[model samples]
Target chain A: MTRIVFLGWLKEMAGCAERQVELPSLATPEELIAFVAGDNQSLAEQLAEPSIRMIINKSVLAGKTLPDTIEEVAFMPPLSGG
Target chain B: MIKVQSDIFDPGAELNNFMQGRTDMGAVVSFTGHVRGQNDISALELEHYAEYTETEIGKIEIQAQRRWPGIHTHIIHRYGKMKPGEPIVFVAVCSAHRQDSFRAATFLMDSLKTRAPFWKKEISGDKGVWIEPKASDYAAEKQWTNKV
Candidate 1:
């Protein structure tokens, strides 16, 4: 189980801020994207864009590496100023 | 002092409160950000996560204090509906000299715009649009990574 977090309009669109997803061991980020896409079409469409950022444990992850534990993962839209 | 409020702020009173009991400081620099009436197409509606926004701003203030030792810092960000000419945010820094206070205040506002978790919705003629961070803001924030 991995904790996935969403923010801003994405959270409103998804209807929740956090969720727990149970996935097979050693699943890549691509696989995670597929899993999310299957569950939430709006999220899937947003994630399909290249500009969106994926962060794991506060560090930006660019490669495909699955976490061994259910750590917190954040899916953030492009940030805006106040 | 750090504050996130929906009401308008009196810059004069706020500065006095922040400067009280600070005889050691010689210079104070402050920046007040205002809501622009035109958001490319029309007006903008600002929204934020109350708890998270305050926490993030607190962290920024702490970081500023650490960077400039013995300096006083204050950050105030207003949430919800704000009109043009209204102050949206305030960042003030005080130090022994003008250079340190000036630079720190600028850095705080620049970083806050990029790292802070605030969203804006622009309302135009019969349409509304959400504003996203510009490439320039990202570039500005990236420059600080090496300094930190």
Candidate 2:
């Protein structure tokens, strides 16, 4: 099981801040997001927006391989804080 | 030192506290971020990952240290609601030389502005909008990409 965390508006749209998902070993981050977006079309569209940012293991990631042992991944909107 | 709290803090006091017990330090640079009042922005609501905010700031601090040796970095950011003109963030860097401290403080601020998990929402009257990073912020952070 892996956990995906959401923040700010994404959290509000998703209705929860964090959730655990069990997926096939071959599942990709995109697939994970799709799974999370599940039956919510608006959520799926928002997740697909280009302005969103992804962080895996505390580092900002664009597109990268996800290690099997990865524990948590975060999805965020563009940061605005100083 | 890194902190993510909701209480109001005086940037001057925090700077003095950070400078306390230090005689070898010759240069100290501090930067404070305030909630801008333009465009009818009355307040700001900051949200962050309760577990990862400090750790993420710590990662930036470590990167700053690697970029500038012998530099001491301290970052404090407030979360939750804040009124206009209130302090939102404070970053101070102390080093033996002026150049290192100045560059390190700027580096820390630039990194934190983009890399930190904190998200800001500007409340203008009854309307609220999620703030977006400006092009200048990306340009500022890009200067450090060629290093390490």
Name the best candidate (by DockQ).
2
Q: Return the top candidate by lDDT.
A: 2
- CAPRI quality level assigned to candidate 1 from its DockQ score: medium
Per-residue lDDT of model 1, residues A1-82, tens digit only: 6777776667777678778887565487777777765778767878767777776765567777765664767777776865
Q: All candidates' lDDT scores?
A: 0.77, 0.86
**Candidate 1, which segments miss by more than 4 Å at Cα?**
A1-5, A11-26, A39-42, A48-50, A55-74, B39-43
What stretches of model 2 exceed 4 Å from their correct place? Answer: A1-3, A19-26, A56-71
TM-score of each: 0.77, 0.88
For all the candidates, what are their Cα RMSDs to the real structure? 3.6, 2.4
Candidate 1 per-residue lDDT, tens place, B26-104, comes to 9999998887876554555676655566777778888888887878888888877666777888888999999889878
